[model samples]
Target: MAEMVGIAFAFSYIGDAFHGSQIQPEVRTVQKDLQIAFHKAKFAGSNPLLRFSSRTDAGVTARMNVAVCVVKKSVWQKMGDLRFRRALNDHLKDVVVWAAEETSEDWNPRMASRRVYRFRLETMRQFNKPHDEGKLLEMMKLFEGTHDFTGYCRPEEGRITTRTVDYCKPWSIDGRLVGFEIAAQSFLWNQVRRIAWAMSEVALGTSSIEVIQEALGKGEQPPFFGLGPSKWLTLWAIEYEDISFTDKSGDFFENLSAPPVGINGRQFEIWQQSADHEQKQLLLNSWLSYL
Candidate 1:
């Protein structure tokens, strides 16, 4: 019997196309789709041959999520990373396997060095509340460094809510405040979404900084700011030690020109929706270009 090897790959998907990242019975999911694609590609291994670096909720797109699949060493040696990626993508639907590399047989994608998330604040305009840029950036900085994020996250049994945020800052595109970016070694479920909501509230003057301070002060009773919309959230990046995938997706960063201005009312709402779709398509196209 040939020994089994692991191949790690970076992929992107339109979250709207699936129920979520994890597998669920009687419903479509990223993992379920990957499993089917793997089978179609003739990759032989265990029933669940893949391990994901992170999990995302429904309607949450991912620019770069990683997974490792176990396959016969002989097959991998013959196919190579490029062919392996192409084969799986050939069977994938709405999922682009952009980059891949051979990995240790025991490699675990969950043990990542860092994870990054982005929350599109422009989506908040739908509420007719334009945020104060300075206030938004200020509130985001408060989450930096280590703290008990119990108030900013939905707690799960047997899970510690305390976590470290490496950095949190405003993410601008073409001089326009489009969103915020946050990075951490790991995060509690819904942590980023909750933080986004809190910052949005403070920036809009609907809530005060005191509320955020109280929430981060480790109080017995913490304040709640609600969850942000998942559709505008994306798992932007993940990093791992000793293994790296090249950014074969050509530079689309500079190509994202500043959005148009001077539009308002129902027409502006339509533009917002169209703008989001445009961004998603640009990302998808970039990844596909590597194939």
Candidate 2:
């Protein structure tokens, strides 16, 4: 019978595989693949739908990205079956459909209470030597509270360009690399990558915290600055409050049939990409040298 089941899957998609994350009739995407697999398995059609919490850039990777989809009870019941797991693995190999499970039918990946993202830095891309990551972390002082991240993203976003960052600080994953973990209820397109660029600016004495805040306060488009290769930004994790889960699965799901329409998110990512290319490449080169 038809039922709303919150199924979350953690996976990876090589940046080169498709034309970004959303499904387009003219192109392929992670969403398209998920839909295909479900369609082939007979669990998706008009009744069940899949939704993602965040959309990473074409070349970006995720360490803890999340998505939820409703599927037939029969498919949900078979989630633990070894063969089913293997079958999914076979179809999703390089894309990595690593985990799947039941969640509240009302689950929304975007509405999560908090999201943690890690920007992994690989030092010395050319000579392969590790630099003093400590020197690179002082810029983090500028990220501690709510600020207008407009300087870190594009101006074409259909919705409000301002956002609040719960916490952001830089740290060393090991002596080899320095990374920054940013936790926020939500982020704008290219926000994290650009902030990384600001950090790089600080390290080089090309800029300062005042510069960063001045930009944020002024709502300027992030100075054509973006960070290392998309590979470095990973969606570390997405968390939800336990109270958001409910026993009334059917009713809760029924309420999810239509997501609000007028306010469109993801509108600025397209423009942000063009400007990010050079910014990311410059940082990648410098970042590679850090190792």
Candidate 3:
């Protein structure tokens, strides 16, 4: 049997068009697109098996995600890292391959050191009232330490619910967009969204801090607080030790560092442009209605 070689790569996706990161039969997904690109590039055989660091749900964008796959040694020698990225990008539309490197066969994305996810909340629309920053901060503190988040996540059989949260905090962006950042080694299904839901309730005065405390004490699912919309959430970054990646675009440092203003600042600028255009069109339509 021919020896197998491993390759690791990082990619980003808009996620609006994907059902999820995992491949599902009869549905479009990031994994499906990636597999097709691998085949088109001839980097892997027909049965290319790719493993991802994290599985993001529908409508959740990722700024940086990691994936690893093992292929025949001959294929790796032919394609190399640069050519593989270039060929993969040609077959992808919304997904872009930013970095690629060779790795040992035993290396996989599951060994990632840490993962960060950011949830953006439109407080003005969701709360319909002024937010209390102090109270929100108090709620955020509850999520920092080790806790059984069974109540804050969808239950899965044979899975442990107790997880350590390295950091969980809420901050304001431009005074309207509320951003919640969560960092951990891993997360349960729907964990971040549910935590955002509970915190929003506290900020809006619909629920008190004691409610979250009680849920933690019980270590069971809390009373229904609607899950935050998936569209506003993004997988911000994944971290790993002993691995250095060279950007395919040759702008590694510029892209890796957070901009001087911040990530939300850049996102808000894009959002505001679309919002302003829609507002102007609506005003024009209203004027035409009178005529």
Cα lDDT listed for each candidate = 0.80, 0.58, 0.74
Per-residue lDDT of model 1, residues 135-218, tens digit only: 777888888998888788777899988899999988887677877899999998999988888877788787887778777976
Instruction: Point to the candidate with the largest lDDT.
Output: 1
Clashes of each: 0, 11, 1
- The numbered model that scores best in TM-score is 1
Candidate 3 segments exceeding 4 Å error:
1-3, 73-78, 171-177, 244-291
Ranking by TM-score: 1, 3, 2
lDDT string, candidate 3, 31-60, tens digits: 999999888877587668899999999978
Candidates 2 and 3 compared by TM-score, better number = 3
lDDT winner between candidates 1 and 3 = 1
CA shift at 182, candidate 3, in angstroms? 0.7
lDDT of 3: 0.74
Q: How far is candidate 1 from the true structure (C-alpha RMSD, Å)?
A: 2.1
Query: TM-score of predicted model 3?
Result: 0.80
